[model samples]
Every structure is written in structure tokens, then in C-alpha cells.
Target chain A: MQFNANTKMAEVIHVNYLLLPILNRFDIQLGFGDKTISEICAEQKINVDFFLEIINSFHDYNYFPQDRLQSFPLDLIIEYILKSHYYYINIKVPLIETTIITLSTSSDKLQNKYVQLIVKFFQEYKEELINHITDEEIRVYPYMLSVDKALRSGNIGKELVEKVKKNPIRIIESEHTNIEDKLFDLKNIIIKYLPPATNYSLSNTLLIELFRLEQDLNDHARIEDKVLVPKVEMLENQILQKL
Target chain B: MNLKKTIICVKSPIIYRGIAYCIHSIQPGIELEHYNNIDKLLKDDNHEDKLFILDINLLPDPAFYFLERMFVNFQDLTLIALSERFLSDKLAVYFRGSILITDSEEIVKNKLKNIIDTGKEINRTNRKNSAISEREQEVLRLVAFGFTNKQISDQLYISTHTVITHRKNISSKLGIKTIAGLTVYAIINGIISPDEML
Candidate 1:
């Protein structure tokens, strides 16, 4: 049922309950080492929205230190990489590997070829993902957090704040852009996972999983853009006021 | 002309709070006058020869009526418009040719000295476009137009104490020691033309 725009928040929350359990399972599978991507989906029960939210929250939580007193701690940055980047790769790689295995065993040659193409795409996706996470943790998050602390304490001089504000995150976000371009290219190659003739069960399952993964990453980028950058900007202003 | 004591008029509580803060920060010597209505300001015996800070928003419709009255009654009084928003038509018709407008107290103190300096400039030909910082010109024009301290405060959306501080700065910069001195300086400087001077 379509809900009206003016629907109450409580009603929206109630509707969300239908998918909650599936989302909880995805979260648990992603959080724990219990199930591979293929195994998680083989169960045929998952909450797509909740799964996206978890991915988005992981990205946001990593961008800034949750402990206000820690003042943009280093550990938070590492944890972000561990959760959003490393964990994502771990789950996705096995799913692709299993899908490739399932495709190989299929009776139809067209279905086997489709799975082969997906496996190749996942291989390149994993490489790009690793580099993106490393660059953020090593360069971007540290500089941003440091600048935030300096601004809050009023120790950051006017000249420095002006300079940093002008540039903000120079290297990390640029790399992210490059990585996103590659992801887009990969997506185009997959072409919405359209299976050739003779493909049936494997084709449907692969399409479903790939669509879900694409959605999860898109959500991850959005939370970073909206919540993380604004938080950093606020911190920068507070620090500048002190100086 | 012996520089006479400066006087300030204001109207609002929020602006009065800001003015109090500014005064506490920068203590300038001047006499401050507070009034709730234009009637009280106009009825004052000391209206003539005093620098009046008026809140343009407080005046009734066809503001020219009040402007003309002040111009006719007090020949040497300087009027300034202290207001939140200075609409172009209102400014052009009522304040443009006569009064100055300002929004913030800090701008008033910082820019008043420049307005006074430019006013002292004998040849008006060399006057720069922003001869007075926008804020100082605002307070100066309001003072010239006959606004009370409280009225200026309410109109500018600042504190009455800020109006007082702006007035003190206006007096010191013009080297005017009294309200009469400020009025004469304002007239001589052409801040308010002879026709507009009250």
C-alpha cells in the first residue's frame, strides 16, 4: 500500500515492521561471520531498506568520532574502514564466487556465460573498493578531524582555517570520484544483469542480489555527503570561533 | 562651534540588550534619551539642536509628514533612521535625500568616525560614495531625524545602549561636545540638507 506524504511518523514506523526481521538478518549476517553473501540470500529472506540503512549508518559513523570528548579520534576512522569497506568486500566476494559456481553447474550455456560475466565484474569491484577505503582512512578522515579539533579550540589561526576551508578534503574525495566512475562503468557493463535466453533460476537470483548491492553502495555515498560533511563543517566553525 | 554633549534615543528591549553589551565593552561618553513614542520625542523642549536617533518603523504612514514636521520645527536637529529593513522607496522618499540608515551597533561605532571626517571635508565634491560606513551613516541620519533612544533601538533591532554608543562615537568623531554642536556639524557637513534639517 502506498502511504501519503503526510503520513505520521508512527505509522511509517509501523509499516517498517514488516521488513524489520529481514533487515535484522542481513545486519546480523553482515556483522557476524556466520553467512557468506550467497548463503544469506539462499535463505530468501531479507529486508532491503534496513540493509541500506545499516550500510548508510556504517558510512556516517566512520566519518566522525561518536565520542565528543575524544574529539575526532583515529580509532573511529579505522572502524569505519573495517565495517563499511572490509566487511562489505568479505560478504560480496563469497556471494560472487558462489554465484559463479552455481552458474558453472547450470544446464544452460547462456546462464553459465552470464554468471561468468558477473564474477569478472565482482573481481574488479573488490580491487577498487580496497583502494577507496585505504585512501579515506590514511589521508582524508585524519586531516578533516584534526582541522575540526583546531577550529573548536580556537587555536586554529584565521589564515589556516581559510586555507583548509577553501580546499576541505582535497585528495580523498577526488579518489572517491574516480572510484565512483569505475563503479558506474562496471554497472554499465552488467547492464542491470539482463540474462540471455535459456537462463532462468540462476539469472533471477543473481539479478536480485546485484540490484540490492548497488542500492546499498548508493546509500553509503549519500550519508557521507549529507551527514558527514555537515558535521565536519560545524566542527570547523566552532574551532574557528575559539581561535 | 564648541562640541556639545551627544544624545541617543532608542525603543526596543532586544536592541537595548545588545546596546548594553556594546556599551559595557566600549565605554564612550554621551547623554542617552529613551522614549517609547514619537509624540514624547517631539514634545520634548530640548528637541531643537539635538542629534535625534529615530526608528523609521515607529512613524505613522506617509513618513514624509513626520519628516516635514521635524524639518520645519527644529532647524538644526539631525535625523537618522535606525531600522531592521530599509526599503528602497521608503528610504528614497523619506530618508534618501535627508536621513542615514544603519542596522548594527558595531558598524555604527566603526563607521561614525569616517562620516564625521567626510562631513568635515569642506568640498562635498571629493566625498566618497561610502563616506560613512553604512552603519554609522544609519545612526547619524537617525539622530539628525529626531528619533529617541528607545525608538532607534526598536527600529534598528538593536539595544538602546548601542544607540548611546553610536551617538558617543558620532560626537567624538565630529569633535562636537554637545547636542547643539552635533546639530551644527551635521548641517555644515550636508549630512542632512538645509531643507531636510530639523
Candidate 2:
């Protein structure tokens, strides 16, 4: 179901618990009692329209209104993007690593070996993921924000313009595919090759976390590719035309 | 008919042990004659209706011609390609089925069961014109179970390129492109066990 400003915030969570982490991105805590999304946004001083669009898109993948999202100030989108990156590096990555460590310690010898291989695979993936995230943080996101700033101020700095021409967002776009492919391979290696674990709950938890991270990352990429990149591209083009 | 005799022509003791263990696990009473060389395997005269698991890597140069000649001489021989890696398509065409040294005991048993149940030669022409050949079905099952292209190729004695081609054909024929979608189809079609999902 497509949630709107009128939809009860609690009802949204009841329908899809996956939205819980996403809600946390906006600092929307669980104590929201009987508050409609509009009411909560007013209470929290969050943008009701932006909240509705983000939640609706997250709730239903097909519900993304790209034009509407892009129309919002790029700052709002980038803030969420930065928060997601923070979540991945600080929360999700550590959580998965600890889960692997826990499962490996508790599993039998056969499953332990599998978990060790998984650790190696995940370590490589983690390095690549962090590198990708660092590239975005250190380079791509800055370029995007600079472009947005230049477009808004109606004045592009000479150095910033040169940087824009040198580093297009397409490089980051291709890296997204590589990181995603590695994640997919990691999941399959565990699913297809691993011997069944004696500590089933721990193994299942690892699987669940991997799947959740994958889905969330894909959604995050969609925002970057479909909404963020195009908006930045438009800004870049406008600035280039002025030049 | 019960599988009365089998021959394994592999040099590596480890691979030989693995194949022997799987065979014994499946049919404990069956006879398995091991030969470390092609000449030794060829010298044996009783080849009718016998299962032969031969390692293509161990075979001398021009393995394809030798394999074809062996098949022609023993029309009833059931040849299963045993390889550490995928065999070239030219060499793979002679086998009734194939198994990898890296294959799980269950996978080895399944391939053996399939070949024994069908008891048919690898008719290349018929497979080429068919909607989805038996080999393609094997590829589909492995693909559904989340085996990568290289893994599927290694297990099936086909090259990675061949695996990709089969995957494309399978996707087109079944109208399913994603691995998850193909997996659901496999579960529905009984290509793999639902219990394996756990």
C-alpha cells in the first residue's frame, strides 16, 4: 500500500517492519502513538512531503516518484544519503561482522571452515564496500553538493567547474554495480556451498542481515542513480550552459 | 538392471577416493575397477552396459578422438566425464554425463541416478533441436541453487561460456531471468528439493 501524509505512522510500521530502520533515519522513534505521518512531521519539524515520498518509496519499490523526489532540494536527499552511508559503515557492517564471528565460534568444524571462507569473502567485500563508500564521501557526494550549490547560487567556481568536468558521477554508478555483484556472490557462496550449520539461528541471522543490507543498498543505489544523479546532472548542465 | 560393474580411470588418489566413496555410498555392492591409465582401462574387454567415469585431464593428447573411438567400440558403455575442471565441448560430447571432483556427494549421486535411470547415449543432434535438453535442465537446477557460471561449468564438464549460453537459453525458454525466479521455478518443477532451501 502507498503511504501518504495522512497514513498513520504506526500503521506503516505494522504493515512493513522493514520501514523501521528507514524511519530511524529520520529519527522517527517507536513512541509515535496514533500520529498520522502529517502530524508526526509537524511535531518533529520534518518536511511532510519529503517524509511521505521517502517512506512511500521505501515501503513500495514501485511507488517511487522520481520527479517529485528530484524536485525537493538536493540537501534533503544528500542528508538522507549521508545518513545511510553512516548506517552502513557504523551499524550494518559491524553488525554483520560480529554475526559472522559469533556464528563461526559457535558452529561445528565443518561449518567453521565455511564461515572462515565467508569471513575472507566478506572481508574483501567489506574493504571494497568501504572503499566505494569512501570514494562517494570523499569525491562523488562533494561533487554533487558542489554542483547543487553552484546551480543554486547561480555562480560556479572555476576550480569546481574543472572538477565537475574531470569526475562525472558515472564512475560511481559503475562502482555500485561492482559492489552489488560482490554482495550477491557472497550471499550465494553462503547459500549454495556452505554446509548446514549446527547453530541454525546464528546462521539464519547472518543470512537475514545480508538480505536486508542488500535490499537497503539497492534502494540507496536507486536514489543515487535515478533521483540524485539526474538532478546533479541537470545542475551540472545548467552551470555548463552558463559557462 | 542393477549397475553390475563400473570403471574409474583417474590418476589422483584423492579424486579416486571421492568418486569411489560416492559410488559406494549410493550402491554399496557394486564393483568398481580403478585404472590410473587409459591403456589399462582399454585393455579390459568387458565394457557392455558398464559405467565408466574417466578423468579427461588424465587422458593423453587428442582425447576426443580416443574417446569417440572407445564409444564406437563399446556402444553400450555409459561414459561419465570426471574432471577437476570443465572439459572442452569437443571432449565433453562423448560422455553420458559428467561429475566434478569438487561436487558434493549428493550431486554426484544425483548425476549417477540420472544417467542410470535414462540409460541413453548423449545424442547431440536431438539435444540441439530440443526445447530444453537434459543438460540444460542440469544447468538450470545448479543455477537455481545459486551456483555461479564458473561453478556450474566446473560441475557439468562444460566451459563457462557454454554455461552462459545455456543460462540465456533457459531464461528465454522459461521467461524467467532472475536467479530467484529461476529457483522458484525449479522448486515448482521439482528440479531441486525444497528442503535444500534451508
Task: Indicate which candidate wins on lDDT.
Answer: 2
Question: Model 1, which residues run further than 4 Å from truth?
Answer: A1-82, A105-115, A151-167, A178-199, A237-243, B1-198
Q: What lDDT tens digits, residue by residue, belong to model 1 across residues A142-217?
A: 7676776565465776666675667665334644634454444444433422335354566556655665566556
TM-score, each model?
Answer: 0.35, 0.61
lDDT over C-alpha atoms for residue A74 of model 1: 33
lDDT of 2 by residue, B111-165 (tens): 6765664455334433333345556767987886788899888777679999999
Which segments of model 2 are wrong by more than 4 Å?
A175-177, B1-198
Native contact fraction, candidates in order? 0.00, 0.00
lDDT of 1: 0.50
How far is B80's C-alpha from truth in model 1 (Å)? 88
How much lDDT does each candidate structure score?
Answer: 0.50, 0.77
RMSD of 2: 11.3
